[model samples]
Target chain A: MQQVIQANLKDNDNIEPVFSHFETQLNGERSSAWHQKRKAALEELKSLTYPTTKNEEWKYTNIAKVLANDYAFNAPSDLTKEEISKFSLSELEAHKLVFVNGIFREEFSDYSSEKGLHILSLKAAYQAHADLIEAHFSEIASTKEEPFTALSTAFAFNGVFILAEKSAVASKPIFILNITDTSDYPVIAQPRNLVIARENSEVTVIEDFVSVGGKPAFLNYVSEFKVEQSAKVDHYKLQNKGDNNFYIGTTQVHQSDKSNYNNTVATLGGGLIRNNLNILLDGEYCEAFMNGLYMLKDKDHVDNHTMVDHLKPNSYSNEMYKGIMDGHSTGVFNGKIYVRQYAQKTNAFQENKNILLSENATVDTKPQLEIWADDVKCSHGATTGALDEEPLFYLRSRGIGEDKARALLMNAFAEDVISRIKSETFKSHIETLISNRLENR
Target chain B: MLEIKNLHASVEDKKILNGISLKVNAGEVHAIMGPNGSGKSTLASVLAGKEDFEVEEGEALYNGQDLLDMSPEDRAREGIFLAFQYPVEIPGVSNTNFLKTAINEIRKYKGEEPLDAVAFLKKMKEKMKLVNIDQSLMSRSLNEGFSGGEKKRNEIFHMAMLEPKLAILDETDSGLDIDALRIVANGVNALKSPDNATIVVTHYQRLLDYIVPDFVHVLYKGRIVKSGTKELALELEDKGYDWIKKEVEEGVI
Candidate 1:
């Protein structure tokens, strides 16, 4: 046991203090069932070490340096409306919920006025809808196995809680903006979010992650979504955490019979970023779509791990993720598809393409498929290369400068994924963000 | 407007152009007729400043400026256009947007203001008639999934838009049907003026019937072995390039 602790965690003594400080803050909630789960997750976290490159799951991404730094768990922020407005998408007409440093700020949030839709902070949901919170929390995303999920389950106190009842359709999309303020000092924020779409309900959720200050910060975010029978859920995650931040995100999804789930995540900026997306098609005739794009530059690194498990028959899952890396940055893509024994007639397709602009820029991609079913149609492909010289030359010979030509090709490579986004305003917003980043690359 | 003086070029240390020279002035079209693997496309690419071909010896003077010294885009901004034999398909970049960017960048390089969106669209609509290009095709990705004839016609459309002083058409008539060839040639003829020149490099003399050249040169073994009037193209078409190959091998005029 002692050797196992030494193998997993670099400094056991540092974690002991962090956990105790968090436990002391849970004064009234110490006796709640949720706190008990948090305690159990904390124990599980103690045994799990920060992953090194030696681990198969962490092969290309090394989190040792990120773990070596000490940061404030409950970071304080003095964010004003003006400061918050800088990151706001004024063009989007969606219900907004803002979180600062893992804590929900009601003053800055606007709730949806539609009926049968409930959006609340985790604490408010705990008081108003205890049964729903207890039934779904940590159920879709088990915290006992994954290190970051367990860390988020243990330390996170506040996050967004959304529920859509039967046949309820959100008139407008819900935008959850998670802002980590590191203006004063280095910080670590863990936000646990849960979304439940009941039978025949539909909703679109946009999760935007950004940081204001230049200080080194760590954001451990976990979100679990349950798509009930015949329900539909569209999820979008856009991350631009600037130069001095490290982010680890986990998104777990469970789909019911005939449910539809669509997710699109774009990571444009971060010092080091890792995202884990897991989906379980538990019922027949369910469909899932995952589209992602990441454009990294400088020394920034982004790793995306995605898993889709077809547990029942006649399910469909498709994934397309494209990346463009410039400077000395690196990227990793590991996509897995699983078909159970009884999950016959499953159709799964996965493709990942990458473009390395600079000689030093690199990418590692792996597609894993485990099939126990006989009648499954599954295809996966991965491609990594520099920008096509033919297109570059073609553009340049037309009076477009070399830099502009490269940017044009890079943007075109990313458009397929961006075009999949349904919202015109949001799509154009993402287009602006990506085109601006590719302008001087 | 274009002068080549014993220009020598190679790709990957293998000589392709061995001391080829030609001279063209404004208001005139020159037809370069070559057999397969005779370095016809290589000459076109070298003039457009393709990086794969290294200019080993000699020089190409475009309006008295060393063409080899400029980058491909700089050469383009200076009114040198090469209509590719195989136009590349760039998905997600609309043809209109690409042409607009190219025009603005060239204008920027020439110390001129860019055309506004309204003005640019007006120009595009006017030029669309030159090649009979449909308006809907201009909104699609640049030449992606375009037919062989459509791609060739697009090259002419681009030529009309850029309005180059020296246009090098490298096998632009290849894989083109007769009607498509006529439309492309007509667009080229429509864009010709006393201030600009055209160099048509082709394997067949079929395209010359539409846009007749002032001079026809037979290129064999990396050098222009014969130079004649437009009637030379008809003579070559009737006798085939084997005669020219035999003439070159025998050192006969």
Candidate 2:
């Protein structure tokens, strides 16, 4: 482990300039209550080191390929209408916020809601509502051990800030688009977003990362969400970057009493992708559902690490993640559910299932449960298997060809998770996408 | 039409079907009644081109073509269907969609265009009526959480949709209750036509009472030891398989 860390540190010089520039930017800003916290986070990041394969959480996922690459920190850049339009969610016509290279592109954004909903860029929010932004940012995410979270805090740029006032329910969901264009050079962009749903408020946020062209880029992103008592919030993180790009993202959510938080992270495309999601249940009677679907082919690698902490009694958490791996692709799913001693009567269920299409395809799944409360009902299961040949033969015996039968079975394996999606349109869209991917194969 | 000449097959180096010979013409129903471990299911599996069973000797001809030479999908495309003893449960794939894909794949193999959704649904409604399958069953995932009777009915439903020339019912009456047995038999009887053939494999004579066979062959020790008309099934039911084994032991017909 020491040798690996030494090797990683030797290569860290390439990214040192980005960290230096981040420190300069932070020191240049005016002092505030949140400034000390940000400074402390930066100091933690400087003290800690990047993770390697020796780390148990990242054993199967190789992050060395990313640290070895020389990538410059990207600032705000001018994006044309044509480039921004490509990132729009045509299926969703709600309020949209477009960010080019991790910076807010206001000309391409639309927040036409007249309700008590505040949607602004992080920079704008820092100037306009510094108190709220300062109180919530980096508060939900742990910056001490996570190097990526520390880096995101140190080089935080223009990310969307959304605030739903007390008792306000926004009819439409807020969409945040993060577009990357690394055609000119290899670059890294860290976008930090903070979403606060006040007491009894309701809102939905959709965060998307898309690439304009087939460029080799790196995206390090972190978003913190705080839900007050009796609030309901739904979030979706979609990573559809180009095949040549790498993406590392973390979504930290904190739920208060009687609040509900639902998150769905879909990783469909990326050269190498790692998603770390943490949901903390701080209040009683709160419910959280974390569902994810990852479809990978070729040599792509996708890793998902999710932790659901049950801190209060009467809170429930359900997590289900499914992956379809083909070719030489690999997928890793590590899901942990922790039930505290006081979290009695808690109901938690977790399941991770993966299907390997090719002989070379692999999947590593670990569904873990740490329960200190004996009264809680908790169960976790993980399964990694190839397509059932008998089922395939049963379908073929009915005149369905082998290929079509395999595809049907594969799609069916993923449909259980896809159908659980609350939005019908989103479910159907994902269904179509999976079908097209199978068809192309 | 189907013809088997000295067919021999094995699984994992264990011989199952040894020097079996049989023949069936179009518009004929052949019943294979055998005792336990008599290779009744093995014959069905071998004919359907299951990959696990290796054919070490002999040849099978379906419609004057080499049946054993084609892949399982190709054999299915050539109008050979097998109703499994234990139907597989495919979760999340609707019955209607599964049947549609099967029908379209077979049609494509025969150089025909895929059916439109409306046309497929129209045909599916008719087939559902034949099997007495409910419309709700068609919308649910294929065979997922279905009762034993419903699984058998769905098999017949698939047979009706594919319209195979030769249908092999492998112990289709194993798990059915009296009423379900009657319904499954009735569905099979209704689907019978002059252009297609049926091969029924059963351990009891109860199913033969409903879907009467033109011929009944007793498979013992992986070979047909006796062959006769519908009366043979009745005789076996009365005297039991031990009587047949005695005859074989005594070298009598």
Candidate 3:
């Protein structure tokens, strides 16, 4: 249990390797010790096979489009700080880590270091706190089964590393802005991150993926979170990329006894987006929640896969994801809950619901529960259908037009999850983004 | 004012309203009484342009315009309001916000500007008195967690705000206690004006004691077989409607 789990790589014939552009990286670390670790991650990546629709977990998502086009590597570009101002949430005063083209830009980044609050980029943190980063960096999130995670690990240089010490929280939330702006050719950016929350500490992280130009940018990202005993963490990932961008992300969390983990993934804009999230209840009396909402239009595609493993007894997990699909878009959700043999008295619930707005739009969701313990309670359900016409008719009968009626009904449907958010500032921010997206469609 | 001629309709290819014809003028209250499955509510639904019902052959004129040709929202905007028998509960939508949106949409249809927030709240406060509605109830989601009586009262409150020229109360008196019945009837009476009309559909004569009707018609099967004044309600209550069924069975209309 103290060592990292190992995974061997085998090549599959269906997936064509389009990652030759990532043969080298621009990591600023000159330390010889860290260079050897990066080299080994890339060597492991070469032996692994990429997943395709033929795989059971990737059946609904076809990666032909991603493999068809050629993507360039991270190219050095001259973009002023004002250029990325459009993607910054300036309204919220907090720590900012700006990564442009997968390299940390110090001029556009700023942070306030409160008590026990340590926030810096992975590159800078490795330079200053090498021992702390080496001890915890790849210790939990392994590059074994997921080749994409291995690839990101090989080239990760400009992501965020956050730590909230015992009972210490930053004055505000931390914003990690990963902007991909490569105007010449299609490029790729890998931003790897790690978060550590000490005992009884609480912090929130907002990680955003955005693009500015017409280049077909590909984002291969990985993030690891370690929540110690009695600590709380709220993590949000907002994926709003360009129409030609592709995003593949993996997030791993290790929770201790009496710790709490809340994770939400909101995919507002992306051509092809996939999220793989894994949470492990490493101690008893722990709780974890996973809630996601994806709003897709214009032939886009989004897929979410989550797994929660209970390693100890008396733990709880609740997972729910909803999708609103319009145009010819597609969505996929697969949730799995694993209760170990000795994890008795475990409570786990999972639900996935999708509303298809058009006949051509589609969704495939599977919520599964695997329990080895006899005294545990677990339930899973999945539903995908078009919007109910009765509510549409009722609203129209009250003098609201058909378009506005549809928008209001969708908003109400989203409210079931949006209401769970505690911050009015954050809730209204997402509400306005979603409303504007629906109205323009 | 409204007029119907040979109105026939069906739901899911099953005939419901067969050849119903009636006339209602301004300043008049007409009550249509019938037993269960007698098509009284069907007639009201057809008048309100519910799309679930397919009009086989019918013509309805509201102010000399073809009422059957309008959409449900357009019909509502053109001064034709039908209080639903079972109101729909919409979660996450506040009652006050729904009312405001409805009022503004209806006003926009008539080429009028929307009311400001202050003006809108002022008007809402005045009409809320008609039902004696609590201010707290206005902030909650529409009809969510509401009692049956509260839902019925909210319907009447909506009627008071819309002020339609032709208001159809379909089964509004059902599932109400005597107190709630009196309050709802009083709300209707307070909203009445010389330029508007109402058509009440019910199964019992108990509600008639509160909302007095100028004319009462007996609907058997799908057609109106008999017509009389308010005194007819007493007769129907006295005879228990069996006599009318027997008369209709013998073709003695």
Candidate maximizing DockQ: 1
* Residue-by-residue lDDT tens digits, candidate 3, A1-441: 122111112342222233222333334454456555666677776677678888999999877666555555445656787888877877767688888877788889888677998988887788777887888887778887767887787666668888888999667888889988867656677788989999999998888888877867778888999999999998888887766888888899999999999998888878899899999999999999999999888888999999999989999999889899988888989899999999999999998889998898888888878889999989989888888877777677677777877888888888777776655566677888888987887
iRMSD, model 1, in Å: 0.4
User: Residue A46 in model 1: shift from native, Å?
Assistant: 3.0
Error of 1 at A398 (Å): 1.0
Please report the candidate that would top TM-score against the real structure.
1
A141-219: candidate 2 lDDT, tens digit per residue: 8897988898787667578888889988988888888888776545577788899999999998888888865446778
TM-score of structure candidate 2: 0.94
1 or 2, which is superior by lDDT?
1
Give one digit per residue, the lDDT tens place, for model 1 in B1-253: 7889998999999999999989999999999998999999999999998999988899989899998999999999999999999999999999999999999999999999999999998888889998899888898999999999889889999989999999999999999989999999999999999999999999999999998999999888899999999999999999999988888778895
Q: What DockQ does predicted model 3 obtain?
A: 0.67
Clashing residue pairs, candidate 1?
A8-A49, B1-B25
Docking class of 2: medium
User: What lDDT tens digits, residue by residue, belong to model 3 across residues B89-157?
Assistant: 888888898888889999998999998999988888998988988788899988889888898899888
* Residue-level lDDT tens digits of model 1 in A129-167: 888877889888987668888888877679988899999
